[model samples]
Target: MVNPLDHPLFARVSHYINLINFLVLVPTGFLIHFPYTGAPINLVRNLHFIFMYSFLINGFVRFYWSLFSKHKDLVSGFLWNKHDLKTFWPQIKYYLFIGKQPNNPNKYNPLQKTAYLSFPVLALLQAATGFILYKPEKFGGVVSALGGMSAVRGMHYLIMIIFLAIISVHVYLVFTEATEMFWLMFFGKTEHKKGI
Candidate 1:
């Protein structure tokens, strides 16, 4: 049994590490600005920045590492295509309980591809706006381009909300739609009747 040349093992390892950053960043983003948190705003800001760095570093590293990976599927699976669009209808029907699940699914379904691919993009947008909000004077041009510091803040906040919502759905789908997925992601293997 020859294993597929492109294993997702390393990419999967990087993925869980990347998810940890969001887990902390989302809460801190709200807690820092929450009127009732009663905690020092700077403390929450510092915590949020820490996770931001981790997220950026992990994302950058995974992207660069994927370039040299033998297992290209790990990197390529996030790309959306015509096939993904074709597959999307059945996935929608499956979610609505009107279609049977796809038996031999690709590395991801269309919705998963869309969600996973959007994370880094949204993160980068959030990061750029965050930095601008962090030092408006330094990014005065960007602040003005985005309308103003308040607008930048609103964009950053909106990105956070979207990230949290997508992540919540992602987690629920991974656990419920196929519990084997969780184990496969964690252990990098599963007992399939045939090949992965």
Candidate 2:
């Protein structure tokens, strides 16, 4: 069977969506980190709110499609397994220059699996905190549960930083390891190879 990663179009779409999310959400999220001062603050705040809702909706649709669509296996591969944990250290070593390559080249590397697992958790934290901060009155229960507006805001800021760091590493790895694969995400084509 052909590996799905070899499909350029799929890779391109994945890369494109991630880039879109980063471009639209990151800057506005950063601005929301600081205290607002003027009319521009209102504009930024509006954009932030709009993007947050957009992201939430986009994420839900993606999740639903992944779970129920034909590509469910792709999503399943991202889930943690004992084998992933076993290879985690070797994968780290490979990335750190101690090893030439990972022992197993499944759909995703151990690091990728770990990162994928964390993405949803971090996104949830960000969304939860963002909602709490967005409407301290309406979401007052959540805000209080999270220890007030200040605490929720602080967590939201921290999660944003973490999200950015993950994106930076993800982008770097995508470019360095497989530029062609990255291009596939946008163009949606993959090179053909003979049976294994």
1-196 per-residue lDDT for model 2 (tens digits): 3344544343345446656776877787767666566637777878877767766666666566567766664455677677788888888888898987756657777788778668768877888777777778998777778788888888988888888888888889978986656544544444434441
RMSD of 1: 4.4
lDDT value, candidate 1, whole model = 0.77
Candidate 1: clashing pairs of residues: 6-71
**The 10-residue segment with the lowest total lDDT in model 2:** 187-196
Evaluated at residue 14, the lDDT of candidate 2 is 49
Which lDDT values do the candidates have, in the order given?
A: 0.77, 0.70
Q: In model 1, which regions exceed 4 Å deviation?
A: 1-8, 35-38, 74-76, 98-105, 187-196
